[model samples]
Target: MAAKTEDLTELSNIISTNVKNYLSHVPTPPTLRPTPPVPVTDEVAAEAREQLLLACRRVISLVGGPIETVMGMSAAFHQTTAMKLAYDMKLAHNVPLDGSPIALGELAAKTGASEETIVRVMRALTLQDVFVETAPGYFAHTSGSAVIGIPGIEALIGHWTDESFASAPHISDALRENNFQPPEDSRKLAFNRAFDTNKNFFEYAYTEDKPMGARFSQAMTAAGTARGPYNLVAVYEPLRAAPKGTTLVDIGGGIGHVAIAAAQKFPNLNCVVQDIGMVVSEGRDGLPEELKDRVEFQENDFFKGQPIGGPGVYYYLRHILHDHPDPWVSLSRPISWEKGDSLGGILSHIASVMDSSSRILIDEDIMNEHMGPEGNKMTITLDFQMLVMCNGKERTEAQWAALLKSADERLVIEKVWRAKRNDSGIIEARLA
Candidate 1:
């Protein structure tokens, strides 16, 4: 026990030192590091650093080692039966976003599943705190589940639960199958064998009346409507404040959350939300009676073409590019080398309409293999889901830059910003 404690302490110290080094190089925000009336004394600054390091050490000790935690998560990923049950219960219960207590029988009824099945599933989820049982057979939601409840969460979950994602259930298969890339026919074969159908997973879900499809739509709306409204406003604030007559086009915007947020933030700025007809119709129904006139939802399939011609402040593709692999390249190529025309085509379309001043902001994870075990593992997991569902793949910074560079000769990346709410990153590109 003493030895264990010493090991934890040393690990904590290492984490603290690394954190301090990282923070030291970043320019402190003016609000966070306001100009002091008097110069900061060395002794005071040193003491502050010590306090910060101690706090970091405490956090590290509490969380345990990064490697250990990652290994544990990898192990958990291998154990999917538990996750699936938790997902089912959460969907059935109508658990509040804030996570109030719920009854299992009630959830079972709502989901149209048997009580025994629900109970068994809940047992597994409760173990992981995906759903917390306040009492035996009674559960409550958590922040983790609440986030998962957001509209897009269902799509993500549905994609994962599909047989395509399940065929190679072992993590070793994921790692060993050259990061889970198979030839196109072979990939299709795996999926068909799993589902006993040739149809893609999404199409299959749509046909089978999987609640996950609608839930996915709602979850996407929840995530976008909640974080998107504010973040969209903030991201476009610079453009909003720019010279008048600025038109902003939201590309593949599901239900105009970003556009609505922008309109609310800057009433003077003109905005349009472009998406598929089905999504636009759904969004239109849910729009506040007042904002319908102000915000227009246009039927535009970004994969084919963007209808909005822009001399706009921003052409934003939020969480869209990550859903597609490089277009022209065959799916068999190493995901890193698979350069395609889909993303490039969209950017080219946007560029054709842009003036020299227009900008493009892509909100997605700019994966870094070296960031830490948490990010790397999560990204790879997500990548596998993408492969199974949509033939899409996540891109690293170099991959993103390469795509942007190839998309339009006039476009140049200005900044890559990280989100405070999640591990997502925004790659901001401007027409040079």
Candidate 2:
């Protein structure tokens, strides 16, 4: 035990040193950094961030004694609770924009939350470095609090706090009821169980509350923005390689963000954004003035036969496949996939319709081989989140290769394009 304590203390010192080293180079909080922060796209900054993340994980691993460790695990719910309260109350919005500290009473009055309650919640969040008490009974924005105010970020937080937080606790029961198999039915997953509904997550989000659905799309955009160097297009080689007039189909692309970005960047490329009727209509109506001639919207159920198919057409699926099990891709033809299945099925069907030179680009998290304490946080968190909500999963490179092979014997992995700053990899497959 003495040796263990000494090792932990040494690890703690290493963490402190690394953190100081990082701050020396990047003096400002990421939120306050210039629009398109240098650190976000810089290779050196990314490497430093990775090292800090690893050290933090090492520290996290040494957190408490047996009883304290168990209690700490149980207390994980507290962070979610505090985040939800602050977001719902718009407490972050109440903070001074210029970074000046505000008295606790003044902030409470601005947000209309009880001052005492606000104090408790804000103080709890401060423990996470979300907000800082600059002086007694006063609060100010830290990097975290400031960033939460960005459009779509608060929505992402809202989605997690309200929707995801409610469902996470039910994962154990969902598994037990499903015979310990990762469920294949979206309607039977923990999200449905928590909501006491048979509808899938998207159906509930879209049909139940239009605003919520819009927020989800916005949240996705925010996520893309946060990825910096890993933004969908930057990691896709095929898009860069495309000649003028290349028709790119964005399957299940919401609001055509990726397509719009591509169209704006590569003037010669024509994009077809496909999705359900509602989303396509929105994308079509909101199509930026400049992209009007270059990008078009189409309502096509991906589960059904891909409507636009020809030789040389590029198909892009960003953050789509992991939502369901492997079997749904092929079944998309016979029936709508209220439940999910593998990418192999859809890949096979698409491959059947493709011209010999056509390629498919899959943008998603490629789980690392060794996921220890310092594993990629987004990938690790989302893997379990997928299991609970849609019975889906994140795949590794080997798994991606296998899935593509199983989808079409003629399909071969062309290449994998990865960004220096993000966890996602773009897997390219082409007909052999």
Candidate 3:
């Protein structure tokens, strides 16, 4: 036993040392590159390169097994029935939004099941920290579960988990086909089979049963409301400081959350929230009566054309563009483009309205293949979900740059702001 313990200790030390050495050799990301390379003698450069290579190799050897273990655990957790059942139990228990402590018997009664079943589900969820069994049989909601309480959260989760939509179930087929078609094809088939129509997933969700549709809308509103404040503060605060009474247009601003928040944050800043007629109609009653005069909701479709007659400081788009594919010409055909003639075409139109000093802030996930572990995982998962549901794909920085260049010759990516909540990055562009 003593010898085995010593061996394990030595192994652990070796693993730690290798990881440190490996990380030390990682090349600086291109975005972080200096203007010019520092000159070094050939001998010294060669020695440094050799050391870096050796360190990386040693680190890989030490950590490869453990890394694979972590990846497996992640995959299993996402794809397991245990996880799904636990989520369902939590949702049905109504513990998250209820904001009250729940006893096991009460949870079981609420869910219309036996106490044993509820206990088992709670125990499983407890393992994932989705909920806590505070005192053996009583449970409380965890922070993780609160976010999922919003209406659209469960629908989105369900949509992703459906056997026909999940990429995990089709990954093997995708590998064999050497195509991204497996999930794509499955999504198309599922929607067609279920709804007998070719509508986008969100559109389908909107037209579904009362509870589900309401949930979807609520989820979207919740997501926008939760992130809207931060996004506005991150970009608008600086812009607001530059000049007072700057009119800001929020394109496709669902429910006017972004505009409302901005209005509250910058009392001097006039704002317009534009969307389709239905969304604007729904959002009308939610705005404070005082804000009604200042923050107006317009029935405008961006694809048809932007209408605020801007010379505003900035135009903001939050979580909007990822809903469509690139090559805006091809992408615009199937969808409604009433706001502007085309997705790319509208940018030119929006640019025409903007003054020389105006800027565009797009608050969406800017996919970075080399983002840190948590960010990479979440973005990649979202990317696949986009593909399956909307035929949309997340874009890397280069992809975004290309899209902007194609959209309008006058628009240029000035800088990108990374989201604090996750690995997402915001592309900030200026009219050139």
Candidate 4:
């Protein structure tokens, strides 16, 4: 126990030293640093951040020793609840934007929520360093709380706390009911169980619950933006000199941001951002005027076949494949997937249209072996969330290769356009 306690103490030291070290690096106001405020693209900074993440994970695991981690995680749901309440009540916005403190009463008045309730929610948030309490009743934003009220961010929170939150508690039930197997049917997942409807997540979002659907659309954009600005570093060279007159189809592309960015950089590439009707409409409306001729929005269902085929056509799928289980890439049973919505089904269409020169680019999180027992909890969290919301998953590199091959025997990955920043990137494939 002494050794365990010492380890925890060391993590606390890491925490204390980390703050001092990071702040020491930051230049004081009125004088900017020579280096970028955040060296997002720098390899050295990424390594530093990753070490910090490992330390944080160690502390998290250590917390389980002091207190049962299950209980700790269970109790943490209140933080989510409080956050949901805070966003719905506009508590983050009610605080003065310029860093001025607001009293509890003022916050309550702005949100039309009771002061008693406001205090409870604020108390929950402050413990997580979301909002700070300077005096007895006064509050200000911390880094965590400051971004809560941003437009797409608010919707992301809402989408998570609403349906996703509601479904998470049912994961065990969702699994046990399916004989602890990877369920191929979307409607049989936790989200359907939570909502007491047979509709799958997308059906529930767009048809059964339009408001949730709208929030989901906004949340997706917010989710992407939060990940980082659209990265084309992976496809920069090939896209810059894209095969002549290629109408690059961005399957399931939302608002066509990636496609738009691609068109601007790649003169030879024309793009058609294909999605459902609503997403197509939104993309068309938001597309920049200068790039309108270069990029076009077309209503298309990804589950259906690819529309165009030629000598060297391009198909780009960003963050799309992982949202499904590959029926062809079996879990408990080989050739198990019967659902038409499987990754194999989707890839089959693209493969059918591919010639030797034609390319398919999958931009997704490809999980890899990392430094710790449990690597990158965000990826794990997403994997579970997919199980809860859509009966989907994240995949390893081997699994990705298997999935593509399962789609078509001749399909082969030519390269991985890996970014310096993270494990997620574009996998470029062509017919063998």
State residue 230's C-alpha deviation in candidate 2, in Å: 4.6
Tens-digit lDDT string for candidate 3 (1-432): 111222445545644564455445445411211122222223333334334344443444445677776686666644356556655665433673444568877777776767887676666666766666668778777655554554455555554444224434434443355453433322253344445555545555555444544455555665554432456665434666756777778887878887887788787877788886667777897989888777888887565566656455678887777866554312234343223233434465576667777878777777875643224455687686665455567888888887777777777888888655444656888877
Model 4 score (lDDT)? 0.75
Residue 116's lDDT within candidate 3 is: 81
Which candidate achieves the best TM-score against the true structure?
2
What is candidate 2's local distance difference test score? 0.77
Candidate-wise lDDT, in order = 0.59, 0.77, 0.60, 0.75
Q: What's each prediction's TM-score?
A: 0.67, 0.89, 0.69, 0.87
Superior candidate under TM-score, 1 versus 2: 2
Best-to-worst ranking by TM-score: 2, 4, 3, 1
Off by over 4 Å in 1: 1-6, 11-79, 86-120, 130-213, 225-230, 328-344, 369-371, 374-380
- 1 or 3, greater by lDDT: 3
Candidate 2: stretches off by over 4 Å: 1-39, 63-70, 230-232, 330-345
Residue-level lDDT tens digits of model 1 in 1-432: 111343556656655664565456435511211122122223334344444454554455457777876676667654466556556555623764444666867777777777887677666665655657778777677544554554465555644554434654433443345655543322253444555665544445545545645655555665454433245655434755655556777787777777777777777667678876667787788777766666777887554455666454678788777665554221112221124332325677776667767788887766775543234345576676666555567888888878876776677888877654344667888878
lDDT of 4 by residue, 53-124 (tens): 667767776765756777777787787899888877888788976667898888888889999998899889
Q: In model 2, which range of ten residues has the least summed lDDT?
A: 32-41
In candidate 2 the C-alpha lDDT for residue 304 amounts to 55
Model 1 poorest ten-residue lDDT run? 328-337
Give the CA lDDT, 0 to 100, for residue 333 in model 2: 24
